[model samples]
Target: MSKSKTTIAKPSVLSDFKEITKMRLALSVVFSSLAGYLLGVETVDFKTLTLLAFGGYFMVGASNAFNQIIEKDLDALMDRTKNRPIPAGHMSVNTAFIIATLFTILGIGILYTINKQTAMFGAISIFIYTCMYTPLKTKTPIAVFVGAIPGAIPFMLGWVAATNDFGIEPGTLFALQFFWQFPHFWAIGWFLYDDYKKGGFFMLPTGKQDKGTAVQCIMYTIWTILVSIVPVFGFTGRLQLSVVAMVLVLLAGLWMLYYAIGLFKKMTEKAAKQLMLVSVSYITLVQIIYVVDKFIR
Candidate 1:
């Protein structure tokens, strides 16, 4: 009986770890960082690439862990977050804190090995996320804006890791990710509006599921597409995109924009969810296209 219980406890612990770190989300962030690194690199260095992947994951994980700790009570109040480790009573706040602290230290240490700029940006992402974004969620809808900063960093963080310099390339990458967040997150805010409200978190710009919010989603989707094509103009230095690549990127953006407009016309939860999924796919495809264009050029 004791041996059987030990096996069950092990799986439970692993599940709790995955939940605390938000494993899927962290991996996605790491992928963005790698894509950025690939776009910036003239020739790949697998060592630095590997380090960036692990470091990026650790940093995002740390931020998420800290977020869960700070929002434990609020998390319990919402269906979307109620099953998280701390809120579910599967892990202690102290244990989560320790894990977060360790991740912070390890992440920064690993990133610093690449360069000071990479580490600095990583640290800033964590600070903005845990200090500013998390608390502001309960106070105002502007939290989404603040949260976008950290959310946008991983892409540019890769460029900095690869080049160890701050330039127009990374800045453009940052802008692309930064603007992309509004539509993506607002779609999430639109569908999950009720769930978020239960936690006192207002994520939409107008703070309601009305025409006003839908309009903003369309507006930002336009802005994201515009920014995405900026590289084709030959003004973003090393970030230039071929005409073919630009056309492909435009098509992908338009695909997402269609869903954004659908949300405006339908104004239903289903439409919002569709926009959210398309926005996610749009960003991922854009990143992959950018990298492929770079090498093929």
Candidate 2:
């Protein structure tokens, strides 16, 4: 009697790369970094800009990969994250860990070649995200605040990479991103409250979606809007936003606020979802406005 042997296939390198990086999220981070670079640089340096883009992607990808690795068990328990590469068995923990370490090293090395501060910030972002924020998610609702620190670093990191120093310009960038994160993340928390609760993650300040959380979202959204327009008044000094840009940004903020208010009034899942979508649009559009304003003014 003869027996046939079964062949096991290996995963493609490209697919593995995408799964580890969470390509879509990485791309979004890269886009924000590009906008920061454009705003920070008075005259475009194609070579430097390219380096920042690649470095930003590598750093953020590593952070996200490590986050998935740490939360693999919780991810499997949550409906929203059950299909993630780590949770779904698309990649092994050891393989993901190796990939994350490689990315962190490569990313920091690339940024260090450009300048030391950029590399330092890259390392800090990874450490805060993976080491502090990942564990805090399961322990406290304030994790969102702690997580926002590293989450908001990419925009400012790009500016520092361009100038190789922290200044009013980078400070302004940091402020804009810092305030924006609260509303943006809260909206997501509101929408995914049930799923997060299931996984023992405390995302909302109240740990329950209600008027208080929605009101906080609205307040933060307003603060972000105010900060976005402050550059127009010359108060930001080197990072001034123009009148046209200010008007455009204010409109976007109002649009986002409308959704936030609607969520407060209705307090329904549909309204929460709408606010979440609007928050995403608001951040993306505001970043574009900042970059375009730099060129126009």
Best by lDDT: 1
Expressed as tens digits, the lDDT of each residue in 1-297 for candidate 2 is 001111223444455568668888788888887887787776788888888888888998899889999899999998887766677666789989998989998899888987999899889989999999999999998888888888788888888877788988888888888888887788788888888988999888888888899899889888888888888888776787778888999999999999989988998878988988888888899999888778876
Count of backbone collisions within predicted model 2? 1
Would you list the C-alpha lDDT of every candidate in the order shown? Answer: 0.94, 0.84
Write the residue-wise lDDT of candidate 1 on 1-297 in tens digits: 124423588887888899899999999999999999999898999999999999999999999999999999999998988878898888999999999999999999999999999999999999999999999999998999999999999999999999999899999999999989998999999999999999999899999999999999999899999999999999998888999999999999999999999999999999999999998889999999999999999
lDDT score of residue 246 within candidate 1: 99
TM of each candidate vs. truth: 0.97, 0.93
Model 1 ranges off by over 4 Å: 1-7
Most accurate candidate by TM-score = 1
Provide the lDDT at 173 for model 1: 93
